[model samples]
Target chain A: MDNMEDNIKCVTCTAPVNIAVIKYWGKRDEELVLPVNSSVSVTLDQAQLRAKTTVMASPSFPNDRMWLNGKEQSMDSKRIQNLLNEIKQWRKEKHNGDTCTDGLLMWKVHICSENNFPTAAGLASSAAGYACLAYSLAKLYNVEGDLSAIARRGSGSACRSMYGGFVEWDMGSQEDGSDSVSRQIASENHWPELRVLLLVVSDQQKSMGSTEGMQATLKTSQLMDRRIQCVPESVEKIKEAILKKDFKTFAEITMKDSNQFHAVCLDSCPPIFYLTDVSKQIIQLVHAFNSSCGITKVAYTFDAGPNACLYLLEEDVGRVLSLICHFFPPDKDDLNTFVQGLQTPSISPLKVLLWT
Target chain B: MDNMEDNIKCVTCTAPVNIAVIKYWGKRDEELVLPVNSSVSVTLDQAQLRAKTTVMASPSFPNDRMWLNGKEQSMDSKRIQNLLNEIKQWRKEKHNGDTCTDGLLMWKVHICSENNFPTAAGLASSAAGYACLAYSLAKLYNVEGDLSAIARRGSGSACRSMYGGFVEWDMGSQEDGSDSVSRQIASENHWPELRVLLLVVSDQQKSMGSTEGMQATLKTSQLMDRRIQCVPESVEKIKEAILKKDFKTFAEITMKDSNQFHAVCLDSCPPIFYLTDVSKQIIQLVHAFNSSCGITKVAYTFDAGPNACLYLLEEDVGRVLSLICHFFPPDKDDLNTFVQGLQTPSISPLKVLLWT
Candidate 1:
């Protein structure tokens, strides 16, 4: 009653993470899912997506019970089941020398994930989720490997999630993907003045998932090869720019890379359009505003989603925020809510005001 | 005829033609206006633009009279006046060598041009109009030197109009542009079955002129170098494809080149958006229709404007026409008016329908 009943209770693990400045686009191997080029990312403070997971081994449970974000999902999917089975097998192999099981090992795993903001708001939730899942599971089961290596199996971008601050995923040449792992460049504390504003333009789910869309692009796009080859140089330059705190170079590279990524999406054989009219309008307005102000004060980046994440220097935060508010003026009733939400406590003491 | 009466009289010349498959985008030198790459084009049977010229050399005529299209344009503009003065000087030199000036330098030129379509339709009207004007004036006054060389002075692309069939503009490396000239690739009779459908999306003038836009892009765009360097290979491949009558390769190259050109436009520092929503929609619809049909039947190309030119194999012309008709159905009242204009003797037995 003691051991058997105690095993029925669930245990949980959780991890929080950030976004990549340099994007990861194509995969070298689909099975191992090694990327074709190295990528660099920055982990944000006071803004993150967390993934909480609980894994339990029970003698009485007939099958695995899994829940994601309070909703029960089918463990009937072979992929999830396979991963769970592998974790159990690793645990058993670690403690017991012989493989003799009277019944299938039963475990209940629950994941209650939440983001400070919206899920599909271009904040790289999947990157954080898969990275957290792989890291937490490996720790819980005592998996014999580096956390980054294990995370790579979950998602190519997940490898970069194992580290806390600036991380790089070096795309290795090994067939087994043993060399492909995330390496830390700088910690989050290194760049305290840097602030990112997640501008939620539209909360609609993306029309195309990154995985399927990227795979389609790789298969059919003539521009894919050129983009993959061209982006590495951009990544290298961005790394240097960040190290030197050259905001001008950093902003230029980030914008160019984003544009090039979207260009590849458009140049795909069937064409995948991730940018809406609103997104295009935002880009135009941002450039116009920058030129009008005679300063490169703010920089914007977008992922697979239509939302924009603007990065501003500490000195220019107030002005850029004001511009943003003026451009996206709130409705009469929502003016206060909008202004309160837009204020950046990290950079400015003065609060942002939104006119109805 | 008396010199006084001749001065009062006006002689006008008008010649209109159409553009072919080959496109000319960049120039090596602004002064000589040499192209950076060779291009091939086809001359259309149904000319849509014309150049009208009236020459009067009598003492009574003051200055150069030039009404471009319907408006009385400034011949005093340095560019226009310089060209006219050069032609006059060349005629005077020719007259000095001849005893009778009547056979040679009898006229000063006044030119008025109009397009049956719109000027900003991306139909290469300027190329044809300028070329025709140069050629007609040269013939009228018995000017010396090759007509191609003289036409090149009017407009870089105008040199190609000297021939009525398939023309290739050889982008020579010479500083003086002595070697840069348009050569005939194939006679009009070579591919008589080939046909092009011009779909006029918008007749509004482009925000940026082609020459200005190209210069801006060359100086500001990071992608410009890549485009200029990469396109030569594509151009070579397209030439081979066209020569071999390889529609698949030709279509692929054409689409890629057009996309790259547009990409370069977007990559410009200020960003030039020549494509409208309708243009993008047409591209997407055409691709979807072709892919769904499981055949590559029709290809579309865009110049500096939002208008599209659909190129189809002669065999698939009827099907493509029907598909276009289905998408843009003709109104009953307008259908009669359209058909009345289609009564030209050269009109094919194929029904003519306008796509709005």
Candidate 2:
């Protein structure tokens, strides 16, 4: 939807979700959404999980309005306000007298965003949502070049979703978070053998949002101090692993960092628990599965929820999926929609004794 | 029983369980069961949970034999063998000419032990068992003085169980762990206002024993290095809190240390999870209850198992217990034994909005 009307302008964009392999937890700068440490993320396929948004600017509107997944959501949040103001200001300054869309810059805007997947069950819906919002607004106002930094003002991890495939959020030294933008290290086509399986364990909204949870961890967890120092080195290692296509090294670091991130969550005062018994069982299954295979055939990373995001090679996907099906059989009625993602070659269910 | 018949002398002793608030997780010396850092523990009332051990020495006995819960247990474990050898050696050295008891030291011994509560479910059963064994054997051989250090050889936490109330296991600088003995900070009578409620959530034998679990955390968890440095200062703060009878400070430290210990477990590679959903729910309940009351009324700590050991003041015990019972109802058949500990003053359950 790129057509421009007489007094109103509209643009629609879609952004995919990304799971941080080396996570971004606590924030050094709250307003700017700057991270305490650099992080690495892998963008998921948009076909399975994404946020579709349409931004319309019109002289007829009174003020900024937002509608999320059909329901109207307040745009009064400081994060959202700052994001919209910053983008509009950037457009007004950068494209002062553009012939076609100049009048639309001063006009009020309405944002309608919807996620194909669940919203706040920690599937990184906000990342996709904010990235989509930023991308659409930028495109509508004729703002070109990298908008990752602008996208990050809405959500810290949102910046990573701005790029496809593997991305890195550099924890910039600037207090204003100018260098905290995420850039793609490799496109989706770089790793042809890589495959992912998104296991939707729970669709229920998370009890504590990431922002509040991060604050709790930062204040209460003494271990977080060490984690801050511990992350940068791993970011480099995972990057190297990503480029070399070293699945074993990548898998090892991914699982370790995810566990470490949650460990910090649990270490917080009034400890934040995002993982359920099913999440833990999935973890045990992965370890046992790897031990049984005599190699790291699969790796699992969880976000701020119980759902499990498994990454593995294409060849191993069949055997692993069969093992998963053998253990966690789909509900009788919802069997067709159970394993939703990029299609994997179907193989007969395998007998796996991988209980640890 | 304390009796001497024929050429046999027997002594029975009981020891109460202790829950470490500071936590004794990793060991600097595995063989000696020496901890990497100092810890503080509170001994629970023996009436609620205890291990009774009977040690007998007889010239007719061919070798040392042991029975646990009516089942014969091999004395092949190094910890048992080392404990027995050390005690006999000490007895032979100190009581060479103690006429009646002197001859008993030359004979082989038969040891039988049993715990009133579940074993290997993180109830500190091992602490009670080892303490009881050391006490009864010491009595049989007429070996006097503190057996806390000797008990430590069997299990690191056993040293703390030798005391009646609040105890501290100092992480002695000596490599031999000679100075790492536990001492009573305050007796059970010191805080008559203190009360405890033990929730036996799960008696399932833990997948990983504390010894092996500690090793894994020590090796893989980077945060553990920071935790080692962070604990000693809190140990001092908690000790001060205990001496001052400052429930708030003591409660805060107790809960923080418990969370940190479990956090390290989660941080480990192929992470270990001791707290179940029930345990986590209990944690949330405690926090919510404290917030609702505008004070820290209760503090909960978990060992390697999912069971919750809640510490609160005697005045607040009824309210807290009622809250616990409200959230967690007992099975019809097991209703009578649901809340087991020192008898609390019965009061009406107060209406509480503690679901956080």
Candidate 3:
């Protein structure tokens, strides 16, 4: 709500990160970030990894200002410009000038965003960052219609973070990308027993960004054609597995898709290597651990970076966690350091909320 | 030739190792070593990396005896038995006892094989080893017709080594493997300027043997099906490249095929990791070097080991070799010790030979 004295309207929203089970790799349309195949992801608990974004609109401000994690950044970037344009178009179409004053829609805005976790920790911060920005700004402007589509214009994977549950982004066939949007497949409450562990393999920035890597893959990878053809079947199977809470099938498919993604990277001309030696060792260790138990108790998947995100049932999480600690003891200096804000203190304040 | 007083007949032969440009990763029939797809290779110089074999047949010996690199090994292995049986059947069918003594044909045989380079250097010794054994025995028994076919029974890639210069192993469609044979694509002297440099990255034995690796790939790799379907096209293109003496296309196809083979390994369920960190570094360095040269002056390929075999024109070989020595300076201990047999002294005697 605006403070009438200053003519300042402000809104704050937090969005959690979403980890893809069926990965989104090559893009059909690079400009709109339209994926070659549909993808599904599990939205993580916002208490553990969330981006808190605040948007303030004021007619007195001369220009739009943005800050990310206390560092001021340019708002003239293409992605930011695209998101701002789409939201403004939506506001004009929905409100019909009924509740808006003249020049109010053209007011300059300030955006301040921060993340609880390390930005370079290989976590999907952009997904949460863009999602939070889109949601908070939409609330401040009274914009209507699909917010996920608005977020998709900013970052493709960010569209999935708009919902707290299992989400799927359909790689729509429309040329304008009007039909390409993310929707929640099921609520987070559907699989209450499922637990995800973030194995922070590194805190360094990736050598190849996802955008650059995907473009090279599309241009050079011979296997990309075959992978796109087979991914639709994988998406359907993973979605069904999530609905039924089938950990074994889900784990197998997740691991396979991760490996296939890396394989495609290797198949690229001059090749792109995202996984480090540690990432590879983690892969072997997970398989060995699962084999030791005589069943699939844990599954590991890696994104464009080396960090591994593992999925398991609540009953087996403790055992696997203990195994990880035993093998990879934490550094002595980091024993008392609170890196990730003490690990999601309680579940009470962790609910995913939609900004109104 | 036989000396009646000594009651012994002796034959000596040498075969060169073949470096696959298009690899053979899976088998349709494990027992017969029938490949799922055809493979093309360049048979290297025997003088540089060869397997030498000596076969002796004597009425005085009590039983079959074999020695590998001066150490005695068992002759009861399945592969050894298959090679012996195939040659015996060929001998009986072709010669028809016209010039053979009935008792001499049943004499006991002894085989001794040796290699100058490190057997554990990942140089595809088995290809040369079996090819030499098959050729030597065929000479000893006065057998005729398709010695490469007989070598195929010993080791699949060994069949390709039976020929000089460029070679291809046809993955026959017959269930009985009756038509599966290696054919010479070109003579060894076809491209005299072509040089292959063996960068022995490591002398360690591979953790997984090719037979075991291929079996795992066939059982688990999801991409293996697509790879097999597309390899016939690759085989044709590579053959064309070699015939046309188009070094750029040959290099591109070689590098691509190597990456695809490793990709299939990664796609395998439970996955097989054959390339080490050093191998990956070599790949990057090769690309960087080619980019710097503004052309594909050198190309590198790896088998199921970390060692890299690079193909370049004789003119560029010195530049690449100097580049390698500069980048990967040898340790003090290895300075005096000539590993991989002092790195191909000269191209004078280094010519692929066809066994007749």
Candidate 4:
């Protein structure tokens, strides 16, 4: 303990992305990052898509510093500062030691975070990044408690990423947002046969970042209130489907929620369009494929960007992927390409022939 | 009447297209063509876009026949039959002094209808076509009170085109659609300075015709109920805007209703996409242009097709058109070109400079 300059405690943690089956669109409380309604999501494996964070605390450090995906990010944003300050306060309160002076609690920290996947459009990188940051910092300080609320302060969906597997962020009725915390509905291994495929396409139009976009929708979208009313019941139904392992019901609800979320985005005053023609083709292909199968075999959802996240069962994956490949036939191996033209990769002819 | 082949009565009438500032999306009565809510529209001059119909009744005609845009069309659809049958019934009922055998009522009619505008995407060609058919048939039979209700039998929006200038399709509470009819809000000369530019975009995806699209929305969209509750009030506000010549309010409501209509379309099960990336660019351009002016100088609306119908004052038309031309310049004089790439014609740079 005498060599205080050498006292460096470091922790590295990784967190995965969560695709919302029941989406969180508008926020009732902007500063607290509370959603308008409860939402259900499926967390992907960290190896598939994730944010890895390394948090280091030392007496030698001068001040709090942070880096995101290599470049230094501003620590001045109100939300980021609120998160950092809250963690610092929690470190002191959460420690159960009786030491006269816990000098490490006052020490500044250096944080570095990066995402492994490059195709990051609407992949909820912020959710993974924030959850990783909170988890790493909590480990570094030897703190144990619910970190979901801390993650929620960073991004509304980040709270759902705090747990591994099926999760839900209940939009609690409270003035202080204390009850608005995420809970694990089921474990990652509960529905082992389910899978999600992410198709990433770069966007030419830089959309209004989620923060401003949510605010705009809250103010302008006429359908926002209706969506808010509908989602709580939807969350319950999604939970029931998840527990029953009803892929059909789960898939149907997920696609509907995604469509409704974007619906209101278009309903906004100036309007917002996240789905590119390619994203739309993927959508059309999924519906046509499902219709041809005579049952819901596959489902698709899109976040704030053009990338499409598709969900399907293990049994149907091979045929659905084959169908997607035959129609969409990637121009590149990595699946990152700039799409052009309205030439609908018409799947009607193949729809009846291929899915069998 | 002995030489009945030569004793033929003929009538030719023309009708203009109407742009719905307040849109009607859902049908409370699908067969009766009764809308879920009231809607208001602005009728364009027939000189700009119109449907000309020629109706002739003669004993030489063996059977009832119809031709649309020079091509033969089946007279079998229930909606078309209902419209034709209603006119015949009205003709027999309204003849002030008639012998038992009117003779002309039994004679089969040959109908021909055509639209002048080639850029018919989302331009409400069906509205003009149906309105013209109703008007011509009414004139041929010398039976005239209000033909809007009869036009409603063919297409929901067709009733709105029965009047010139601002018109309102009051969705009356009647099980039989007896009270549901279009009414004139203001004459064609009410707002002389107002102008609309039809930016026709050919769609690669054949959308569900409005009838089917409306049914799908009524069945699937959660926003449809909210929209139904909202438009009756919107109809009042739009009428007020037209009466006062408040271009700002009128433009704002028109854009909102258009956005909402497309919103519900996107929210439908399996979803429906009417706006192409090119269509979305024009939307962005309109919003950006209006934002730059700091006063609502322009507005845009889209129906079931990718084409954009922009509304602006006569004084502002040149600037808006020039801005559109510079960015989305026509590759050909006629301006029908296949678009490619996600190249967002970014107007932010020119938004400030050109509008000044």
Of the candidates shown, which would achieve the greatest TM-score relative to the real structure?
2
Which TM-score does chain B of candidate 4 obtain?
0.89
Candidate 4: the clashing residue pairs are: none
Cα lDDT tens digits, model 1, A1-356, are 11235555444555555566777877878777788678887665533345555555556656556666666777785435444555566667766635635232434454444445445444566666667667556655555766676667666787787777678898888998879988888776666667666666676887788878888778865556766777778878888888787877877777766776676666566566666656666677778777887776666667887777666676666677766666666557655445334345342221232110
The order by descending lDDT is 2, 3, 4, 1
Stretches of candidate 2 exceeding 4 Å from the true structure: A95-102, A118-122, A347-356, B95-105, B118-122, B347-356
Clashing pairs in 1: B11-B54, B12-B53, B13-B53, B20-B42, B22-B40, B22-B41
Residue A220 displacement in candidate 3 (angstroms): 2.4
lDDT score for residue B251 of model 4: 93
Over A192-232, each residue of candidate 3 has an lDDT whose tens digit, in order, gives 88878777777788878888898898898777888888899
Task: Rate residue B348 of model 2 by lDDT.
Answer: 37
- State which docking tier applies to candidate 4: medium
Off by over 4 Å in 1: A1-5, A8-17, A46-116, A120-124, A200-208, A212-229, A321-356, B1-5, B8-23, B47-58, B76-108, B120-124, B144-149, B220-226, B240-246, B314-356
Candidate 1 lDDT (Cα, whole model)? 0.64
Per-candidate DockQ versus the true complex? 0.26, 0.87, 0.58, 0.77
**Stretches > 4 Å off in candidate 3:** A1-5, A96-102, A335-356, B1-5, B95-101, B337-356
Off by over 4 Å in 4: A1-5, A95-101, A119-122, A203-206, A332-356, B1-5, B95-101, B119-122, B203-205, B332-356
Local lDDT at B297 for model 3: 91
RMSD in Å for candidate 3, one decimal?
Answer: 5.0
lDDT, residue A290, model 4: 89
- Please give the lDDT score at residue B236 for candidate 1: 74
